[model samples]
Target: DIEMSTSTRGGLLKGLGRKLAGESLFMTTYVCKSATGMITFTPEAPGRILAFDLEAGQSLICQKDAFMAAQEGVSLEMHFRKRLGAGLFGGEGFILQKITGPGLVFMEIAGDVREYDLAEGEVMRVDPGHIALYEPTVDYDIAAVKGLKNVLFAGEGLFLATLKGPGKVWLQSMPLNNLAAAIRRYIPSKG
Candidate 1:
């Protein structure tokens, strides 16, 4: 086990926030004891690892299970997005993981990853499950699927999470939740 610097409420709150996000009860903090040190972390699912720098005053809002590890100075919080449409139909409940940083963070996404840099006023509508992370500057909302025919026959679900940005957003090509549902279709039923 690695020894970590500990502060009473600060340490406990960070772990608690992660737990509320469906993660393990504890966070492993690795302190570099020398000039340089290494720690290896891998998410349980098969996925791509992504890293980013979070400057002061910026926060990264991510999928519930996306966070992997971070430098010591980073902070963890929870976000309950206020978009009612997203809350009801976006698949990822309104509650999400919020990471605040003046530090570096590493995240894991369910499969191959793609990123987009959105200029001011640009927007993207995405399947909520495919959303991995985005800057707080991005405006996240939800939109209804346009036509009844498309909603009922497209198999694309009824609503999508919309991101309007002057910020960056990342998407995962294969969302584990979708993959699991597909795999369930082929599994033999309990006999």
Candidate 2:
């Protein structure tokens, strides 16, 4: 007896949190009464799907809208950066999604994906939008790109994201915001 129902998964507060994190308020759940059952999931955009099996007490912080799905026992919560600089210029804004585990999770990364394992105290600076996911052990911050010419004309924007670590990081070659900006010029305007 398989049953399906849709509602705000963690009640109203959690649903509201999900909404603030740029996801739909209600979630659909499927129950399997028999011994085994199968289900499929897909991303909303053309991208690669990555699966993670998380241990109890583990957590992964991801870009907003990157979450695809997760199994039971996983919790999706809001993550906020304490620094005003990160909130103002981090590309992802302040509200990111934090998925905690004891179950499997799926994330969608736009375009090609690259992985990096940073040793302790190692740092990698990146265009903020390219950041897809990272382990909680990594320190995330934003640095103002030095030099007036580079900041104004280099086209990398005012601030670059700084990931200092001893943890893994995943970056996407194409972020949806970049893709939209690229084609925006070709779009017809009312004017």
Candidate 3:
């Protein structure tokens, strides 16, 4: 039903990079030779599918493993935090997914979703793992949890993602990792 155009140059490098990012080594492109055909990708979890259009010269950053599929011309790569502290203590570790395109991309966010449009200088702090995706225009950083009681007892981790935006941000109510941890607690462990 479809044809794929393979990259002849640097194919091995791209495949290796994707593998290090916890993705499949090969990215397949589907083309419909027939008059009518459709290509579909389904989310692994039962959650919302979010679509974003990336214009030329624009890019977006997403949580690792969030990328589902994209149009043929889009490019996906790894993005790193510049600060050493962020690399050491940030929620997503040192690297996130960076997508650049003049096309559309679909990503999956677990559970219900909330979207906020932030004006310049507006700031919101969120649990790092809950962040779905954000525009490049937004400034992202990590903040230490405040107060001894809250930091130690809240169970929300030592750092929260601080997003200062003049752009949009998407957050998910339930991250799949969180759900998996919760479920794991109930299952009887075999010694």
Candidate 4:
């Protein structure tokens, strides 16, 4: 047997912050009345689900709506981009989801996952939508793609998200936005 109820872990302000960070305001909690019990979670979209066990004070910054589930000790908060360029053209906008942990956290990646570890001062340029997660040590910003021909005919868009790192980063090959746009093309228009 099990009992369940709504949980607002961090109170009103945190709940409000979660809402701004693209998560639900209320979280559900389950209590097991029997000697043993279990629970399961699934991704909201067609994607891969990955889990991380973080030590106290460790944190990960993730793309909006990436959070799936986490243990009770994990904290979710809104992360703001301090750079105007990042805020305006970074693709993820000004606000992102930041999860801090002393426990396990699960995230949903829109498609296949790729992991990279960057040595100090190394940089990687990526399409903004493909960004999945990164350590706080990463310096994130946006830069315009160089060369007129590349910008006009490369089909890679104008701006690229630049990540300078001394830590690990994760990217997803199929972004949800790209998938939605692809599907939208086939939907019949309402006359």
Indicate which candidate wins on lDDT.
4
Residues 37-80, candidate 3: write the lDDT tens digits.
88777888879898888898678888877889888767887787
Compared with the true structure, the alpha-carbon lDDT of candidate 4 equals 0.92
Better of 1 and 4 by lDDT: 4
Instruction: Flag clash pairs in model 3.
Output: none
Q: Estimate each model's TM-score.
A: 0.88, 0.93, 0.90, 0.95
Residue-wise C-alpha lDDT for candidate 1, range 83-191, written one tens digit per residue: 7777778677877889888899889999889999999999898888889888889999888889999999998888888899899999998888888988999999999
Q: Tens digit of lDDT per residue, candidate 4, span 1-191?
A: 87888967779889999989989898877788999998888887788999999999999999889999888899999999999988898778999999998999999999899999999999999998899999999999999999999999998899999999899999999898898998999999999
Report the CA-based lDDT of candidate 1 relative to the real structure: 0.82
Model 3 alpha-carbon drift over 4 Å, by segment: 4-10
Per-model C-alpha lDDT, please? 0.82, 0.91, 0.82, 0.92
Q: How do these models rank on TM-score, best leading?
A: 4, 2, 3, 1
User: What C-alpha lDDT, on a 0 to 100 scale, does residue 183 get in candidate 1?
Assistant: 91
Model 2, runs deviating above 4 Å: 33-37
The candidate, 3 or 4, that scores higher on lDDT is 4
Which 10 consecutive positions of candidate 4 have the poorest summed lDDT? 1-10
Which residues of candidate 4, in runs, are more than 4 Å off? none
Please give the TM-score that candidate 1 achieves against the real structure: 0.88
